[model samples]
Target: MSDSSFLNWPFFEERHRVLAAALEGWCASHLPVDHSDVDAACKGLVAALGAAGFLQPSGAGAGEKLDVRSLCLIRETLARHDALADFSFAMQGLGMGAVSLFGTEEQRLWLEKTRAGKAIAAFALTEPGSGSDVANTATLAEKVEGGYRLSGEKTYISNGGIADVYVIFARTGEAPGARGLSAFLMPADVAGLTIAERIEVIAPHPLARLKLEGVFLPESALIGKAGEGFKLAMSVLDVFRSTVGAAALGMARRALDEALARVQARKIQGEPLANLQMVQGHLADMALKVDAAALLVYRAAWTKDQGAARVSREAAMAKLYATEAAQEVIDAALQLHGGDGVRHGMKVEELYRDIRALRIYEGASDVQRVVIARTILGEAR
Candidate 1:
């Protein structure tokens, strides 16, 4: 079993431990769902997670803020059992994060069905021309007679095709660059919004390219305010970025577990592989990566829960280190598994594919390095 000792760490509280235990139990019974049909699997997982109340923490009621520690712990645990489960749960929070953090009472009402898993949510910020350049967002949201008309294409949107609602960032021309963006809560059924294409990745989830051609929304659909989309999107990322690291930590832990078992079971030179010093060294390195990643992940989460306003530096560090470390740990685990590691059904093989996208999404490792550097430089100024 993966180490439960991390729960005893001072970074967590009694209630956090309770949540971890309860989620672990629930995952043991319900996870590793069929993936033959990835879309169907995600839909079912969301509903099951909602019915089980595990998804409650993804959203907050009025006057409540998201508990960062809880989000991280749940994601870590879910990822350990099934990466898809983690995706399903994480998207619910990220997809609707803007609503939870900045929406009006009327806008946030959608949280009811979202948190209940009856409705799916999506965040649409990345566009065809801009990936990390939030300021370069080209999607235009033109003020209309009664509402706004959005015209742009968004690619690599999570839950893009399946989501019931999307929080789209578009240029409102309030000012130049980042300052001119605005956010809107657009329903997927809007007349002008269409799924341009479905993207297939090494590890499958419901990802899509979306085309919005004059999609119209009433003024009430505005999230926070016009010209605040950049700030709002950053704020939402501030909360969810650390959780990405938590998911990586979970995958690393699973890789370590699989490695430990492989080392003990496989024999070499007529002795168990665990007896070999070289093999033990690999095992040690894997364990070290997992622990180090966990520490950074939880530290970021705990710092956010302490109400730091923005944990960008900490979250960037956590996301960069944990994801890179998990990639190494999973690679080592696969190497130890010998040729079986490359086989289609092996857990390590699945983890290998699963961990790659973590390093790229949320924020690429190199982008995180830039974030950390910029934060330190700005502080010095």
Candidate 2:
């Protein structure tokens, strides 16, 4: 099995190993359909995941919860089986992570409800003009008599149209950058909050552009201190970005497995493809990349679990290497499959689309490079 060696890695403990096995077992029996209905598929996956109790690791209870190592392991395994499954699981944790990490008592309650699959959650930070530049956000929130009135648009939001609650970042002060921003927990029922457009991508999911037109939020909606939204967003990303790499690692592993199975069973030049030196070389490369990606991903996750408040450099490295590596691995797998790889609804074909979004979201590969460089320079100074 592709997972045989992954369990022996030092980054994982007995619990992680057990969780991986259990999730794999569950997925074998309960995996969702491989159809094209992205939104319906995601909702079904979410409900199934929640019901199966797989969402717990991502949505642990308040105080001393959510084993990061286990979360990564689950993502890696699910991603190997189904990319949409990974998305359904990862977003549950990330969409509500800020509340888990920095929210008030009320927010904690909201998180608990969402974690239980009673509601959907979302994180809204990206605007049309501000993909990687948080400081340049045009979203504005003006303090009203008893609350704040928010006005702006956020694009590329996962679970946007369906989320029951959103952690939204907006400029609260007239100051020019990230320092002027703040975060608020806005309910989907809030006045003037609308889904402007549903976005379609290479691998469609429930993504949308959110428009807030003078939406008034109670003072209690604020999360963390005023002017700390950027920091909060970054902190949440630091914790979750490595998991993205873990998901990519999962995809790469599955792709490698698919290639291996196909090559061993199919004949090319008067023999099994696996007997060819070129095929062997490609398999070796895929194996090496999958192992290396797993190590980087788990290392970052382990660092965060070991009480590091920030894992900027490590997370960036993990995300950058694992995601890019997964792309290469998936491409090689596709090559090994030849025409079958590109066949509609094929596992490798779906993975090809699934892996593309990882590079663009959380932070783009180029943005991650900038982050790593800046962190290195700062440490040196």
The models' CA-based lDDT, in order, is 0.93, 0.88
lDDT by residue for model 1 over 1-381, one digit each (tens)? 899998899999999999999999999999899999989999999999999998899988689989999999999999999999999999999988999998888988888889999988899988888988889999999998999999999999999899999999999999999999999998889999999999999999999999989899999999998999999999999899999999999999999999999889989878998999999999999888888988998999999888898999999999999999999999999999999999999999999999999988877889999999999999999
Q: How do the predictions measure up, each by TM-score?
A: 0.99, 0.97
User: Native-vs-model 1 lDDT?
Assistant: 0.93
* Candidate 2 residue-wise lDDT, 1-381, digit = tens: 776676887877888777878988998887756647877787788778877778777765557555788888889888888888888888889988888888888788877777666778888999999999989988999999998999999999999998889999999994669889999998999999999999988987889999999999989999998889988999889999999999999999999989999999999778999999999999999999988988889899998888887999999999999999999999999989999999987889989999999998999999999999999999999
Candidate 2, pairs of clashing residues: none
Candidate that would win on TM-score:
1
Shift in Å, residue 309, candidate 2: 1.7
Global fold similarity of model 1 (TM-score): 0.99
Candidate 1: stretches off by over 4 Å: none
